[model samples]
Target: MAILKHIANKSADYGKVLDYMLFQHDDFTKKELLDDKGRKMLREEYYIDGMNCEAMLFDEECEMVNEQYHKNKRYDEIKSHHYILSFDPNDKEDHALTGEKAQALGLEFARNNFPGHQALVCTHTDGHNGSGNVHVHIVINSVRKLDVEKQDFMERECDSRAGFKHHLTNNYLRHLQQSVMDICQRENLYQVNLLSPAADKISEKEYWVNRQGQDKLNELNKQIEADGLTPSKTVFQTQKQSLREAIAEIASTATSLTDFQSGLLENYNISLIHKRGRYSYHLPDCEKNISERALGAHYGKDYLLQQFDKNTKGLEKENTQPEEPQKPISSSFPNEPDVSTIFNPSYDYGKDPIAILFVQTNLQLVVDLQNCVKAQQSEAYAQKVKISNLQQMAKTIAYVQEHEYGSQENLLESFEEVSAKLTDARKTLKETETSLRDINQQIHYTGQYLANKKVYIQMVKSKNKGKFRNEHSSEIALYEAAQKFLKAKNPDRQFPSIKDLKAEKEKLTIKRSAQKDTYNYFRDYQKELRTVCSNVDSILGISRIRQQEQEKSQDIS
Candidate 1:
């Protein structure tokens, strides 16, 4: 997924933005790092470029422009706009995304979007919190340097005029996000719909809070382990996460609004507030109530009502008893005995235990086929049909005994079990395949980094550094990207050997093979059970009517 984030800078210093993008910055202080000589330290790994400006002299040119236009004179005036386009970490592994390619895309994006601005387009491979996501930073001077024709995304007259400050509207942000999606699609990279609301809305602040809280919890757990005491809690959940979980749990089973409210209060001590036709939740110890909008669309009133209706229908279906089988009507044809009389002359089919079991189980093979309507028309045909039915009955009985299914319900239960297992097996297989692919990607990148290390080192040491870099730019970018990836994977700076990664890949391949076998086993078992159930239903002439009734009920619902 590629995410676009916008940050408006109010500081008049254009140099600080360029410094932050090009140099190593202190994590907590957000200040550039310096050497003993008091010179800013360039970042170890980054790809820097520019749109409508020199990359190295971005700050100087932007300041000259700002001074010429007298646009960012006041302390409160917006100096620049920073837009970060973060790509999915898997894009590198899955789509062959490199820093050079991302840098080129970033430059293109800046040129197309902020046309008349002195924009610095920088690409970084190392994401915060060791995410290893490749991202691009586009910092455009707030004041346009030149007058230009209006584009479809431009919203105002000043948008195409020089000396006017850049304006960001919600609509413009959406346009930029769409542009990122389009770029990702064109590059065959991993992309997600950035226009839709997230199912779980975690703000940037809340996300960092959760991360910090988890880190603190882990440290606490480490201390407890040092004292030989086991920690009771291993996972940390934010207040919103807890609220979301409570609401989701109750809503899944609640059949009505009252049930939903009461379930939350009784089970989690969370109070529900319905105001202005919207839902909100108040946690037991929280001072303020969190609205449904804060949680996600899934926790909203309309969505919850739909879930409740679905659950109610499911409950009704589960509780409803199966209808009794209807008795066969007698035929009015002359000199022809009806089905009931032909099957049994004196025995009462409605009252007989064996006859009732035959109907309930839908085992047509167990019934006397000689008394069938078609069989009774011919003596020779009746004998042949009886023989066939006897053979089928023996096979059915053997199958039932083999599976230890004493009744129809048992067979149905087995089928359900197999179906569930098959579903789980498929999910596991998919996850395993993903992991295997990740391992292969790791091996590939690790190999690339090792192979191109010498070339990058030579470029750094060469007398004519610019010429060397231009000649071997692709190799250097790949090396840097792979280096950043490996560093993120192993924060201790100990890169794993390619041999070890291949071994891990081999193990994953074996595990995937086993998972595939398990998936196939369940799939085959489910299919066989389904076939048997279908045959029984068809023979009893019950499936078609039952299906029609189900369809009718669905339509009514």
Candidate 2:
């Protein structure tokens, strides 16, 4: 039984997965291998650029052969006939007998059923052992050289349709299985299995391995013996040994088990518990449990306990062992590319989560500034309306004085009344101007804040390389950068520049000790400003209405 499995993904991360599938030695490869990412290397191997198509085979070597076949044939030659066959081994005498039967059956199937199709069969071993389950790769050319020039139209059409080359397809697989089944029945080799009726597919290697049973255990024991250690009689033999060594070392040091456990737990952040029967060392929260079955033989209890003893005498051992000159740090992580510059999308032209959050906050600040500008403009408009009314009143008073000039008494009375009115208007105008100046200054400050905020957002975005979204939020440096922007924009503004704004921002920063707190500060400040403005709208509304009423009265007169 030769088991088959198919897997595929659109991403180019196939190289790492392929290496795992092909080369991993169970625990070693599975544990040591790094995360798989990036584009598949297969495309590069085949030099396929933009060739978005499906591939059938699993092995890379097979892929090379398939590539050659397609390159040589191209589309010029077509397959005229197609045939598939299989053989079983129940009645066959031996491995040689079965192999002969399969080859003969395949050849015969092609000749009888497929008129012009030729057989291209290949055999592969299961790779675990010498169980021979044979399979074939078939390719047939479609184009045929005919002797006669003229032929019946119906027959020519049939030949042309049948001449299309057979590519890999499910139909082809089905055809192969059926062909094998037919041959198996004919040859009386009932043990040959087809994939359908899907008879629990198993690879010949796995089949042989299962049959070989405890021999695999023997191999494991041999590995232990080779490693200069005796085979453990029981599963926890290694753990027990390590425990005994640990206890012996503690006794030598005259140290309590509690002290040792505390030290180990502190360093490793894993639990050390003493049960009634045995002592168990728990794995860290982030780590998966390494099964005793997998590790007990190689990493015996005694070995681990001795390791702890070594750790306890680390300083003494170092004193005895001459200290070599310190080797310079290479600055390169194992298996990592020399990526000096982190792909910080937040800092780059791209938008990361942190950059996005920063931009959004800054944009909000701009919006608040714009609203403040509109508020100032509105107050300015009110001042203009009041001034226009005062000017109109002055004109009327001037006209009255001119008409009463002949009567000294009437003119004097009118002069006094007009003077009072003019004085009041002047006072009102001055106050309005003062208020307008204050509002203008506030608007100016808001504008400055907005500009600084924008720069901060851009700086943060650039720093992150547009990958800010994936970074740890608590570690994000957006806030510090923003604070720098604010300082450069407004040198005089201190820790709490805008009294109300600073208070709100400080609330968010209280818990955060770093730059993260500062960014959060800006977010809270913007939100508070919006709330304050919404509440102040009532006062703004009253001033607007009073100004509008005066204007309407004047318009009516």
Candidate 3:
């Protein structure tokens, strides 16, 4: 049986799809008309082995019935639907059938499903990771030509004339999937239920990341056992491990969405970001965000919510039970706790195991930065809300001052003082914000340096020191520069430890926040000043209106 995936081609480029399935593709360069590593050049042709020139035949049919296509002036429209039918990896029929039978089956399926639509079916015998599987590509035009005297299954179902769409409904798709399963059963070939939920699905980008990571790990493992040291695991591996630990830790305690959000923040220092319509999690100081969907079915927000709704008391009871088998997901990881500190509500981060790791090795710098960012964001939000309240108070004062102020001069003087104070306060806030950003950048460099300090020292002491030095010199140099920057701050050339530096950074961060608070307080005070200016303007408008009414009355009198 085949794994079916539907790709809606809006480019209307059926010819491009034809070129791909027919011609050679270089895996390394992703170039056309070049054979991928495993594909034989003679076998990779439009009419080679068991394949035929059916693409050209289909192109002729499309042109013959293309009358109304010229009227469409839109730059973009649904051009074609490209469906991929991939066979099972273990299926030996791929090696025996020579792709002719697969191509025949694909054509029959497409022709029956999209009767009035022009279709091109091509079979290719290759799979990702060189898995021997015969896959078929079906490209059908979006427009169903009634000039062919045939109505598509969809057109007949909708009771409408065919023109711009060769609709593939859920029932039609399921029918195609079932067709594959039936074909496999008749032929005695390996098959799977296409309608069943996929075991796991990862995006193209993540697939490449894992592919490259595995390649790197394989290369690193070839080094002989000396000093019991292996290459550091890839970032992708680290992220997966972190994600698993974070998920498990949070899931155990979280009974509701509110609990889940707080648990993630306090325990993992992960921020939740909403873009478009979906939710994703961002690590500390990282630009890349991974959706809960991408994490896995288990980690998905909806899934976790369901779990939370299902078992609150039972979940606690389960946690207290004996631990599950540790079959070693990571073969190289040491028997150490994944996280250093428990992120309880009243926990002190400075004394956390993660904080100690920052001192020992700045591996958790991103987490530390995340903590600072959330704190800053919360503080800023609170300050802005207070500013809104002050603005309302200012408007209220304006209404009262309109009657109370004896003259415009007194009000104008008060307004001038408020305006000057507001400007000064804004300047201070801007400066504080800038200071905080600079401090963060500095900390990032320092942390980077500290993280690689051990590797730098080891490389220096080794016999073949220059080998790895070149690999990590730029980051090592950055660390050295950061150290110099820190040393200059101390009059006595005494270099403070990483812990001390982090402590000092925390102090500066606090000072910067205090400056913002000062600015906000001044800004709130100036609200009454703005109200006085408003009162003066209102008093003038009222006086002018009265004069105009009196002149009109004089004419009448």
> Can you tell me which runs of candidate 2 are displaced by over 4 Å?
1-90, 94-100, 112-115, 121-129, 132-163, 192-221, 227-557
- Point out where model 3 deviates above 4 Å: 10-15, 33-54, 60-64, 67-74, 93-98, 146-163, 168-199, 208-230, 235-263, 272-282, 285-296, 305-557
lDDT of 2 by residue, 140-185 (tens): 3332212223222213433423223334356545554555566655
lDDT of 3 by residue, 1-557 (tens): 56787887676444556556666666544556434674534334232211122456555555444546551235476566777878776564322444777777777676656666667777777765456677777777766664344344343543234565666778778877887788777554678877764434455566677667777776675562344754443233446445655675677667887787787787668876656756688888677887766666677666677778776868778889999665342324333222211112242323312111111111110112222323344554344334443443334343333334334454455456656766876776556555554555556656776787787787878888687778878866776787677666555866456576577668767876787676665565455445434433432335456568899999899
Worst 10 residues of 3 by lDDT: 357-366
C-alpha local distance difference test of each model: 0.79, 0.38, 0.58
* Candidate 1 local Cα displacement, residue 471, angstroms: 26
Best-performing candidate as measured by TM-score: 1
Clash count, one per candidate: 0, 37, 2
State the lDDT of candidate 1 residue by residue for 1-557, as single tens digits: 88888888998777888788888887545877799999989876799887778988888998898889877888888888999999999888756788888999998899888888888989988875457889999999998998989999999999999988898998998899899999988775888999988788888678877877888999999999999987766767789987787688678789999999998887677899999999998987989999999998899988899999999999999789797564443545322222222122233323322111121133333334423543454465466555555445434544554444545665677788778878999999878877876777688789999999999999988999999989999999999999988888789998889888988989998998999988887786677667566645544556778899999999999
Clashing pairs in 3: 1-191, 12-79
After superposition of all CA atoms, the RMSD between model 2 and the true structure is 38.7
Higher-TM-score candidate among 1 and 3? 1
RMSD each, Å: 20.2, 38.7, 30.5
